[model samples]
Target: MQQQRWWRGATIYQIYPRSFLDVSGDGVGDLPGIEAKLDYVASLGVDAIWISPFFLSPMADFGYDIADYCAVDPLFGTLADFDRLLARAHSLGLKVMIDQVLSHSSSEHAWFKESRSSRDNPKADWYVWADAKPDGSPPNNWLSIFGGGAWQWEPRRGQYYLHNFLVQQPDLNFHNPAVQQATLDNVKFWLDRGVDGLRLDAINFCFHDRQLRDNPAKPPEKRTGRGFSPDNPYAFQYHHHNNTQPENHAFLERLRALMDQYPDVGALGEISAEDLLGTMTDYTRPGRLHMGYSFELLTEDGSPGFIRRTVEELQAHMTDGWPCWSVSNHDVPRVVSRWGQGSTHPHLASQYNALACSLRGSICLYQGEELGLPEADVPFEAIQDPYGIAFWPTFKGRDGCRTPMPWQPGNGAGFSAATPWLPVPDAHRALSVATQEADADSTLHRFRRFLAWRKRQPALTAGELRFLDAPEPLLVFERTHAKQRMLVAFNLSDQPQSVALPDLDSWHADTGHGLLSGHAEGQRLQLPARGVYYAVAPAA
Candidate 1:
């Protein structure tokens, strides 16, 4: 394995800091809490840990609306605490990656405040600002992912400012060279701190259409997708003018150049657009971002055919770009709840984890996934997400997946001494780490065993992937590395299924947890419910 480019084909664990653990007794997780859990994270057999935003903020969109790129929020601890966390992770052989929310900033940020105060200020062009039309409407027909109208009026300058997300988050004007340099300088601040990598939040939104053109309306049939509910007006438009612009590539090239100065540094971009695979491929081309991941697998559709088609499409379009696959994260519902459709089978989470890691690129495993935790049901009163509040009854927001991690079966779930930011679900308590650690056959153990096993299989980790023809509810593929080929198959449904093998005489099964109750007889292979099969054959 290459030490410098360890991110390639690596399994990165994502930690939602606010809910991971809270040693501060302030109902929020902190850097000290994360440092204390480094041993636990290392035990998972993951290569790195990606911590979500803990930057200085006013808690508007939690930590996404960053107030200061270089400073740590008081709620999350100080700069020294962050340094200690980094040291602890490195001591445990886990690379550390922090979230960089460079696309926008809090309205209270000094830069945004100075920019909006007057048009002639030094930072006047730092944020996206435009004059209203004769009817005093927005400058364009763009909609915010959180709700309606992406433009917000600022009385100080008497101009409408673009905000693709919460109104409190004003989009930065990347068209200005000074603004681009400032963002790169902030990134360099972390690189100087010895951090291994960055998870670039909304990387494609760094630039906008210079023409400020109105986004074309989407047909009613094509309205439902990631980021917003069907009821949200944000889904009404094609969103071409607001994000994924051509100029963004130049900015990414500059960012990549800055990263190249530091050794062992990686950039993983989060992209979402009308053509997600296309955007991912473009953003991750050589001399740009090292890896890019989208919400194709994060959607409500979890059918085997949909998953296969999504990967196939990306494979067809991607030239030399690498992809980072993730099934669940801070922004979406837990995979088991979204895909299992209320099924409590112990194998569901394990199957999803295996499938995600088996793909031909890097992987991100969200926290608590190893424990098979389900999404918590956050009531209307306990909702903390502004996006959920705007679309209530129809959509409950991301609070369900943002709930506190369950470490033990106690009231606090061993997350905090006091009440957590969000209530910990009793169902999650039943799947606590303490309980799973004691059970060898538990999902937690299964994930650990599978990941450890996956690390040993070069074909599954760094091999080229080719899909095989299989029936519904069954996915079959072959992974080929230098002189080594492995056949991988999964029964993605709850019912048993079977797939035909091309040559059974030369293939032998790789024994593991995923192959439970599966056997090959001549040209036919039988798979039990939620079964996974791995077989090795000499390269043809």
Candidate 2:
């Protein structure tokens, strides 16, 4: 259980490679359909497998738009199927991590087709261009989050580039130091091909607004429930000059000095800031990013006073940094169908996924979130999400939590013998993975016994949370360390509830011994209906 900080309190299972598994029948997902589901994602005890981009793309913004940050996307396979998915995910001890997108590319990149073939190539200023103004409009008022003008033009470099999303991607101009050393040599060519880590994508859109200014308006109540939409005018402005730039913190210290030259190679970063937890506590403090994640609980809120004031403002601003907690991914909507509204309610998605692996960071689930797999109403002529076909029905994209991953209850739920690049929802074909691998109180076996008892809790893996003074829809806490403490509680309501641990004075009910045994409280604890409770703090 004390395995060299195996990514601290790790869980990470994300995978979205065009719907995770379609081994060459051409229905999409490949890499031998993720090397034939790397033993079903190493039987879901996940210590790693971040994936998400399969590179070589004109996918407009799919493989987050790279046209080859070193090959692979022949519709997702080859490089000997990503070296047999890195030799079967390092012989199933897991750890792989992938998606690097590096803030923008795919304007058919070959360095943006030689930085838009013009103004004296040597990669003509490598990308955020400009010019237009004094009459010809766009060189400023930036907007685009896939809807309007974040300045496009580029008539073979007459000027105007930027694109905060899909004007075929664009952005990348870390004010050039050979484009941040060829993007740290495409992350040292995937850590010289063994990978092991990097999620980076949109790491603060890699720099802009070198005073080619103009982002001011934003008002409809300071708009923020994260993913900007109020009829999407890119949430009416205030993106104060195209992105969070302070020269992208010296290009994230040259991408954390090329992920600190490799030993156990890590780098998470995806912080799409709008002050995202203050740019994820200044990009993971010590060495720019050994971790970073935000879209804060990927929204559709369930208020316990907004998840206790966003984990009390990320534990009063992450002191030792490290943050990563996603309640669902593949870009939102699937936290049990946006917080159990599409209800199948396996004990309220196992007490909100054991309150998202007893929060304190490093969590990531996604991939049909352990078979409680909601959100799949997909319609719009079988939409393949160009940001939900550009904001239709108010805003229904993200292909209903990026389809596919059903794994058998019949038909292509086994993820394919064919047909899958999206449509699967017959309510996730009886919640498959061969019907929750023969259901033993399945929510995918309570997420493999809540990630193997949170990998034997060193105070829920690297401790220090505090918050225990509960109330509305309850939300206690504890987590300690240097020889254990634990506690954690929640009910976030659905019906039966109660909480009075009397400051946990006589605690021992280790929640029925695994994800807090669906807590029942003979000494006072009945939580079912979005329930959850954890215990261990006794020694005063």
Candidate 3:
């Protein structure tokens, strides 16, 4: 497995601890709970698990805001509990990648507290502190991703500290070499502890423009990039000076050099910028991140052309760096709801999973993805996300996608002994693990079968991809590795479709994935609604 470079073309499943499983009867998921479900996770045939932030936090942004980098929060358990979780996951042959928020830390963090205490405190310059303009305004016009201006007034420091997201989460001064080294040291701590890898959160935001230049305004017609909502105001301008600075590459190299010391350890970064795919390319170059993914596929556009363009564009520039693609995560609405015309189509989810896994890069499958769970309907009364509360009706934020994972059909959906933090939707309960396990033809079983079957195909697992010309609702691609070449096709629509391959000497259809299989009749392949077809040339 060491020679295999396990992360390449790997399937990494993401688990949001707050909603995954609650073993402590506190209505929140914890490390021990993740450990308790290690076997279940392994059963899905994923190569690794990417656990969202479980570090010590005040829960302002629900674990994304870090108060202490080295300690685990009591809400999720202690450092010893993390050790146990790591041990059990490794014992099950699954790598564990934990989230590392390097761009910002909670205001409650001792470093930020000291930095904001006085102008010349020991750690005063540890954070991004800027004096107000002569007119007593923010140094520049920058908007927080959550809402409002990015600057938060610090009365003690007599300046405004930058917060790209929440006011409580202040950005660090990475331009200062001390801050850079300290952050890398924190990363070294986890690698030293034997975690398989790190999921660098907002890694590109580590460095801001040193000049503090004003961000150029983006025209209204050209105002769509990261999130779907226009009400958030973050999408109003081109985020040039705020993040994805040129100096950040050096820091990434430093981080990479640190990770290279650990055997087979890697970093998967989350990139969100004006040029999403282009920045993803830039961040994942040879000496930078091992792999990087963006919010491109997480959008509402689920058309065949859009998906093709995204992968094709990245593949065009993906020379030495690697790519990790995710169709669903805790940050956005569930793909089944977002992609399948505002509803959950079971067949569509199955086809989409196979399609995403079939792509050339590594794959990240969110927790409820296996069961084809759609976005849960979280009402305003139940909303906890601050971002959601800011822009309620127009944009519900990410609460729908962060509900508890249902393990059983009843009794708190087997998630907790008490009322869960987020209510487990009745629909999710019906598609719980226990319920799906009993059904022979469930989406969960299909998912397991596809992943298990995929591991045996080198062409599907680690191969070069080329998209073939096909009509709408049909995505056709070829994956070649060593001597094996595979032709993978998917019907993205609910209606059956057919595609003509036309130029093949001998292509044999493959099976065992348990989806709606397609047939290859003399270069003419017929696909059922949401069907998947796999074929290989004998000489290939």
lDDT winner: 1
- Tens-place lDDT per residue, model 2, 459-529, is 87778788866677787888888777878777766666776666455666574434434464455666776
Global lDDT scores for all candidate models:
0.90, 0.78, 0.89
Question: In terms of TM-score, which candidate is stronger, 2 or 3?
Answer: 3
Model 3, runs deviating above 4 Å: 1-4, 342-345
- lDDT per residue for candidate 3 within 134-236, as digits (tens), equals 9999999999998899998989978999999999999999988999989988988999899988999999899889899999998989877656567767888
Q: After superposition, how far is residue 96 of candidate 1 from its true place, in Å?
A: 0.9
Evaluate model 2: give its lDDT: 0.78
Model 1 per-residue lDDT tens digits across residues 377-425: 9999999999899899798999999998899988889999988999998
Candidate 1 regions exceeding 4 Å error are: 1-3, 513-517
Q: Find the 10 residues in a row with the least total lDDT in model 2.
A: 512-521
TM-score of predicted structure 2: 0.35
In model 3, state the lDDT of residue 215: 96
Candidate scoring better on lDDT of 2 and 3: 3
